[model samples]
Target: MARLKKTVAMVGMMGAGKTAVGSAVARALRVPFLDSDEEIVKAANSTIAEIFERDGEPFFRARETEVLGRLLRGTPCVLSTGGGAYLAESNRRLISEAGVAVWLRADIDLLWQRVRHKTTRPLLRTDNPRETLRKIYEARVPLYGLADIVVDSCPDLSVEEMAGRVIEALRQRPDVLEGE
Candidate 1:
């Protein structure tokens, strides 16, 4: 069997619109759309928070590695990873080796507006949500910058537009030229 093309992996801080943008990109590419968070829940048969609560964040992160590794082993698809997944060196190494990673760079205020209403975030549970985000952004932005491409997650860009940007960026990367 032939090796599949390098998948498009989307990474960024929480609320960077990976899910929304990845889905659109997958649709445009007419390939599978896999969210690592959703896949982790399916593989574990529990919510993300529940996994963290039951097994601890480290254990849950291990699951993230296992599941993401399996996904990367499969055919190329658009993959939306959990916010914290890239923090692990193993995860980042796997993604860099297997596919193109796109960082959807979103401003803090935009992230705040999008995430303020959601309670599903495990890391965002804090006395100061703004501070939490700032700290996370501070830690992850540089890490995310290591990706092959970075697309701005500005509010003005529709999902389709972001998807287009991703595709355009993908076309520019010689490393992702596994398929014609």
Candidate 2:
């Protein structure tokens, strides 16, 4: 088994499979899997949509940063962050300092296919969701590009296969994973 030395923070657009693939990666690595949004929801006792509807994006982002910082400070694990988490310089710095940020690079079309039906995504609750998704994708890709590692998310790859690819990428970073 490979030993995880730093948290693996998954960053990307919505529907990039951060939660799904991160959980699979954690299972393969025998480490815990955490979702920053989930942590925020838990702490607030409300769903992400509720938080957004009640307190707005800025408030939600603040809570996200707090949850992310707390999670990154814990033992090594796979942490899945919300789509906008990496946009903040503070969050990026915190992740870079305490973990490895892995961007799951998926095309806008694929992201749409994955998230179009999901009502849980508060960001896409727009008048023209497709256009909104595209704009959001365009705006965030550059920030996500700054991640420590990039794993292309292909339509043909199953969740386990994607997790394997992430693990393979981590193997190259000896400081992040060792003891294979």
Candidate 3:
């Protein structure tokens, strides 16, 4: 098994396959896998959509920040965050201090294709979801570029292939991953 010296944070726009790829990476590394959105849902006893509808985005974001901070302080693992998590400067700082953030860079069209039919994304519940996703992608790209590593995602790649790409990226940073 590879030795993960720090948490591997998966940060990117929605439909970038953070959770799916992060899970595979954790499996490959023989480490635990954590998801910030899942943690928030567990704590709030509500689905993300429900939370967004009831408590609003600000409330969910606060919970997300708290969950992220707590998780980043824990043992090294693969941590997948919500799409908007890295948009906050404080969350980005926390991740930088405690973990290595990897941006799962996928094209906007690919992201739209992946998430277009998914009703779970509260942010995408717009009249024109494709356009909305494009706007979101445009806004978040710069923020994601600040990550410690970048793993490009292609429509042709399988989940395991994406995970392998992330692992390759992480291996380049010896401080983040060692003792393979």
In the range 6-78, model 1's lDDT, one tens digit per residue, is 8888999889999999999888777889999999999899999999888999999999999999999888999
| Positional deviation of residue 151's Cα in model 3 after best superposition, in angstroms | 0.5
Clashing pairs in 3: none
Worst lDDT window (10 residues) for model 3? 108-117
Cα lDDT tens digits, model 3, 54-155, are 989999999999999999999999999999999999999999999999999999888988898899999999998898898998899999999999999988
Q: Candidate 1's error at 5, in angstroms?
A: 2.1
Pick the winner on TM-score between candidates 1 and 3: 3
lDDT of each: 0.87, 0.97, 0.94
Give residue 31's error in model 2 in angstroms.
0.3
Clashes of each: 0, 0, 0
The positional error of residue 24 in candidate 1, measured at the CA in angstroms, is 0.5
Model 1 pairs in collision: none
In candidate 2, stretches whose alpha carbon ends up further than 4 angstroms from where it belongs are none
- For all predicted structures, in order, the TM-scores are 0.93, 0.99, 0.98
Between candidates 1 and 2, which one is better according to lDDT?
2
